[model samples]
Target: MSHQAIYRKFRPKIFDDVLGQEHVTKTLKNQILSDNIAHAYLFSGIRGTGKTSTAKIFARAVNCTNSHDGNPCNECEICKSILDETNMDVIEMDAASNNGVEDIRELRDKVKFLPVKSKYKVYIIDEVHMLSKGAFNALLKTLEEPPEHLLFILATTEPQKIPATILSRCQRFDLKRIKSSVIVENMEKICQEINVKYDEKALKLIAANSEGAMRDALSILDRCVSFNNEEVDYETVINLLGTVNYQVVMEAASSLMDKSIEKTMILVDDILNSGKELSFFLDELIICFRNMLIIKTTNSTDNLMRVSEDEAEALKNASSKISVDEIVNYIEDLSTAQLECKRSLNPRVLLETKLIKMLHGVNHTDIETLTKRIEELENIIKSGNVPVARQSAKAAPSRQTAVHNDFPAQETRKTVVSEHAVKQETSHDTSNSVQEPRNFENKSDEAIFNAIINGWQAILKKVRSENAGLQAIIRESKLTEVVNKKAVFEFDPKFTFHINAANQPKNRQKFKDVISSFVNDNCEVEFISKREKEEKSNKPKQTIEDIYEDLKNEFGEEIVEFKQED
Candidate 1:
């Protein structure tokens, strides 16, 4: 006999055989048992979740010659005929290929006739969303008022694309993706039934690779079986599926955590030499980081990952050495690299750069440490362990000025003064020279500008610390001017709307508090457009309640509350 695909050969023959969809199966069973089945039924979910298979089972159950409870007796001729696709009463159509209006018109005309050899004439349409709009319109009336002996089963992965009119005529049931554990368990059972020897680790690898698709898992197992002739090993499974082994991923993660760029690069090179895809490597790295983050953040690992017990324990050990923040940074870097790799001509270079960055950039330090270091340096300077350079420079001018005061006769005697006294006299003379009228005025102006700059810096720091979302919007805002207790702020064009929205009364009050604490004034804050100066003046505004009361006296109770804040 020719080889049959695992998904096709092992398709669920009955409701009990369906996996990961107990809720749907139970509901359908109840409907069948109570004789309350709808004329049109819509089954929607991801592929391989048994939408089409469930429809076939339902067709068999409804038309079974020896129906028991809600299941079909496979021994019955009707069930055998339906399974063999030889029954005229049960029609199965692929809407993807037969999406023209003429096909739907023929179906509509056929639904009018009674069942020829079964209790119900069931039409199972797979990929119903692929039907053209005209085809949908043609099938609408017939679906709404089909014969009692006729049942229409529409299966689709995307129900959103189906029209509302067609949806309204049917009862919809959303099937769910089969969980990884369930797929693994079912694959093991299938392996046993087929006399295939496999390990649990191999099954998990296949299940995880399947990503919640039972058919995919079975197909992967089938491929493994074919490659090794019924004795599937973990290595064979990985090689057949082109999946990175968990150990390789773990080693890569460990290297990253230890900041071992050499080891990581070697591992990456090895995988690349093995002809593994860079994108797939990146995807695996992302998953590894995600698992690490989960292990770091959560205390329980019951349902978090689908790895075997030993693998989970290994991951937990790896996760213990790294912090959650580090994992998050690593994931973000890899994710960004993945996006960039898509657009780059050479993805290997991008991948290498990203790995190097992840290995080096995991250690993050904040600005607070730098600020404290600066403060420490200032304190050391203020402790008087060393003479101030500015003061020493001033001594020269002081000595020159003192020479002018004492005249040429004392110049020689002044040179013989003690070093301390000489230094003092020099500092005094330098102070006198430094405090010239014009120079003092310039210093005062500079001091004012410095103060304003410092105040703006403080405001920005507060905004970033308190409101990250807002800070992300207003990337760089500069203090344009301070006139008559009004602070003018100029924002980048990208942040114009953000600044305007934040300047609303409630947020403006918060901004005012931040600015007041920084500049030592309860000043009015005004925002000017970046391109033009249309200053929004902040004046003491009346409350909306007050305005409402005034309007109420003029217009009675019909007056409503309305207020706008600038």
Candidate 2:
């Protein structure tokens, strides 16, 4: 029996064997069949998504005498020779090792020669990004006017590093990360063929830990098989991969959500003591909240969730106890903490500290709950069914007298019988009313306006951080007014492009979201040109946002980036 690793043993022999990359493979197969293949090709993606394997297959397909539907017939002598790494015509060069001007010069010297056996010569260069600048220049020279009989297939994980000149010459195929479901299906088929027993959950766990790399998945499965005597179980997969159970993380989240300090601390201790990495545990916690957020929103365990029935049920049950906003905020908080831990030397202490804060932290979700309750109360009051507080007849008269003495604070009005409303009610004697604005009696319109003015720099800095390009566009804008969770932004008329862009559906939503976080509630944003606001209000005031809508509307998504003339 062959003792090669599972990844090597199960490498795709044909186009159909490659999973989750039909977009790339199918296109290549079509090109091969149509004889429209480019002289230079770039295969770019994350590792182990079959960049090199596909290159080999394509090389063999091009050289095969008996090609069937653009796929190489393995039985053909040319295809079999390439498959067994004996074909000199199909050269596989590891650019990572031979990435020098001399190596490239040697390659250039050989390119003039015709194919030894096949109709065309193919050079498959893996890790093409590693080639030196001089080597890239030399390679560019060769590709500038390539021989009709030569093909260059370059594969790399970091395509950004490749020179743009080199990139422009090749037809680039972007490979995407294989989804967990696709990986699991392949794993199950492999397990059946190999006669290895495995829990489906175990296979899924391996796939998740592989992070979209098929080779990584196979390597993980190999480890699982080795540890579990070819009979892999869920627990064995967990232990081997050091992956924290979703249930365990869910329980910890439950403790945090419940604000059970002791329970949270105990769970943290148990997790750390069990030999799991704190960073990985943090990742699992982040993912737990992320999944909770998904389940909280979608309310279904569709393809989005990659878990078994038991884990799905557990996630749903845990998610039901919390609001979507809570899950989002918790995920954000955990992500921040994870970043902090990564930067800090004492990660364990940081993790423990973060967990403690999570236990007692004042939840933003609570603010949302209060907001909703206040809205409901307002609706009830507007309907003229204010829930009046019961008291003796004596107390009612005293309360009435107090209403006449002064304007009651906004906090006092939440009790439903506002002093202003009561005075108007006694005089007019009517329950019907227009919607009363919920403004803090102490917090005047002028006060809210001034607060926004004072915090303009902080707001601008926030926008700057979110998108530097946007900041460049909206450098001359500011908040002009804020009332009832609605913010008005004034911008100079000359920069109408910025306003139109900022007011577009997407940029407007982003701007509103940032303002909401700043104002601690949902906020609606309105954009007005300085001149327009002045013409309407008969006063001039300077402000803030877009190459937004007009350019987008006029140019479409292929943004024309212009450079200043020197």
Candidate 3:
């Protein structure tokens, strides 16, 4: 006897044995029971989710003479022959290797012959998407209109590559990824049956790392079993797979949240020195943050599975120190780090830099929040809104008031803000430069042009604070001129559509309000294309009487006056 892998040894023998695909399996079982099975079936899903296994079991069940309740008894002769791969009626083909037109033509020739012994001839083609276009054309007619005793089961991980012509002719059954908890439970059952000693947490780590594939889980279990012959523990699993344990994830998260970079670096060094892959480490970090976020945001844990009680408790205790928004920000930051670390030359330094940024509180929302905080502080300081010193009036009879008592009374304004907000504001150099308001109504045209040009970045920020979506549209636009107190905006020829959109009444009003804050008066604005502005530059200016004649043409004679009153 030869040694067999755990996955192959425990291959599913029937539709009921397949895990994580009850939606597909149940439907096939009902079809079999009702004698309404289709001639052609297509099974598609991620790899190792039991497409091939289901096809094999369905083949056996359809040919079993003594099938019970749509399940092959496995005791009958026909089921035994099919299970042992000795049945002539059930033929399995690998479409990856046999994808040429000649191979498909030979298959077409074989389809004409009826089954020798079984009730039907079942052809199972795996990786069916690998079939060439010509091969697909050859099999199209047969797949669409096969003989009464023929059944074709096509399986592929990628169904998008298959032609829609063939896709529409078959009964397609989509499969889903197995849940981690389900994979864990199934592995536990297998471990008990094999009489192998294992830790519960160890199995969970395997399930999580398996990525929703039970076959992958079994393969990992086989490796663990080989590494530690009789007993598999938590240490064995992580060491073998180069994965971080839940303890490391919790401790690292705690160190980062507490801004203890030295301790976090030491932990990183320890993991890397132990040969753990940096990619997997980052993935574990993301999962840790996600789990903590779930516990903080949700009221129940029914939907969350595969998390241990101790881990959940640790996450809860850590959740109190950080906010839900902060946790979400952390997850997003780590998600980007995961991608960056993969492409970076030195992932260790990159990850360390990200940790430093996390300590400083970095994200999109931090910018706008910091701006508001600065405005609040500026108001408080200018108004002397602080706590005043206490004065003693009845202590002694003094000829003059004390220095503390002689000062003007200060009003207190309560402001609650984190130090991270201050740091975020301080990081941007322009946030500290508050421009003085200017009255542009009496100012010269050159002065207004300099104001709009010099203060453009500030105006952009203010507009961003109003609606963030406007920033993308107004990115490359500049103030080219100031004409008759109406600010003229010149946009590129490519931005013709944005010109009209930004000049809408509501958006134009919002722009005017932001500009009014700087100029101290209502600022009317007009957006024009570069070509239109150039064409207008080539034309001559009209006189006041010319503008009057145009007004009189619309409003009649009383509104128009060609001569002066003198």
Candidate 4:
């Protein structure tokens, strides 16, 4: 005889043999022991969860002539016949192939016949959800009230597709996904029975890859055995499955946390070049982050299923370097990427894009990002890196002018931020530059623009408190310039609605009022896209030196110093 597949060779023949479905098995066995049998039974669960196997076991147990504690005696003639597929009374059908109304009608017609050998004629239909609507209608009446000598067993991975009328007529049993621990134990028994050498960790890896499917686990084990016919080692399973190693995931995660884009991208390319599927590697990364989050929050690895103690410790060590909020954000972004990865033709590109975004911390407008930005500013201030400007009695009264004055007095009045913030205040073209005379009441465009950029968040918060819709419209807009008492906000060209909505009389007035209060100037608000800003200013952009000269003219050389951090 040809060698049989491991899954088929080790198929469960009795209730005791089916693993990880004790709930369904115990209930069915009790029904059999008490001589209480339902006409129709429905077993539903994910694939390889023993739905069809349980259906077959229940069918044989109900008809066994020599039953022991609600289990079929395999030695009995009837049980043997059914097990060998030689019993005419126990008919098995694949509803996926025979899903027409005519197929169900034939079964309805056959229900009237008496059993050929067994006490009851049992009909087992697998993938029963594949049946058509008309086929369901055809089977509804007979399933609702079958003949006393007949029984119906239906199994499906997807029970939702089955009609309600058919579902209500049968006793339903939901099988659960088998646990990895149970699967590993079963594989160990199989290996011991077959006299095959194996590593325990290899079995664990197989079980994890199977994703709670017993058949999948067995199939993977069969391949590994065929590959070596000796010891099934952890490395062999990893290579066969083309799964990313846990260490590789840890390294990539560390690179990301360190904000090392080059290292992360190189690691990604290496994984793909080594023939690992991008989706699988992506799934591993998501799981890795999720595990870290679990360990970080719960302070225990008890909830983790597949991670060993050593791996759990490594994860705990890694989790210490990142915050819980960062872990949550990574999980969310990676999960979204996973969904897109499925449909994407270039999954590698998609994966890299998500990784870059995560490394850069680019998710914007959310409360978490806002809070992170605030914390960073606070940290900079706490470190005493921020410069505080002082004023003397000889200084200008305007707060904006007082910021640039280099006074000997110890009285500090304004914060003169570093060049990083000042550089963000770009220099406009001299052709378009407003020639308004500088006064104590009106601030220089440089001061006003810097104030707008620095205080932008506070302005948004004020607007949010009064009108959230206005805040949302301006959320993506950058306050690029404050010229001629008109503040210009540049948004991405794709957000056309922002420009339209922000220009509305009520919204414009409300937003202008908030900005006026923020910068203490009655400035008019204007919204434009970056593309429009580019088009309006056709002159060559100013160089760094040109910007420096402009700042030097506005503020004295003492306050206009440039310091670059390494």
Q: lDDT scores for all predictions?
A: 0.72, 0.74, 0.75, 0.78
Segments of candidate 3 deviating more than 4 angstroms: 1-4, 299-302, 362-364, 367-566
Write the number of the candidate with greater lDDT, choosing between 3 and 4.
4
Candidate 4 ranges beyond 4 A from true positions: 1-4, 299-304, 364-566
In model 4, the clashing pairs are none
TM-score of 3: 0.65
Model 2 regions more than 4 Å off: 1-4, 299-301, 363-367, 373-566
Candidate 1 deviant stretches above 4 angstroms: 1-4, 362-566
CA lDDT for candidate 3:
0.75
lDDT of 3 by residue, 481-541 (tens): 6643457788998997788778765666667667767665545577788898888655632
lDDT (Cα, tens digit) per residue for candidate 4, span 399-486: 3344445453422432233333222223222223233443335665556777888987888899999999889999989887665456
Worst 10 residues of 4 by lDDT: 388-397
Please, what is the TM-score per model? 0.65, 0.66, 0.65, 0.68
Q: Which candidate, 2 or 4, has the higher lDDT?
A: 4
**Model 1 per-residue lDDT tens digits across residues 282-301:** 88888988987888788766
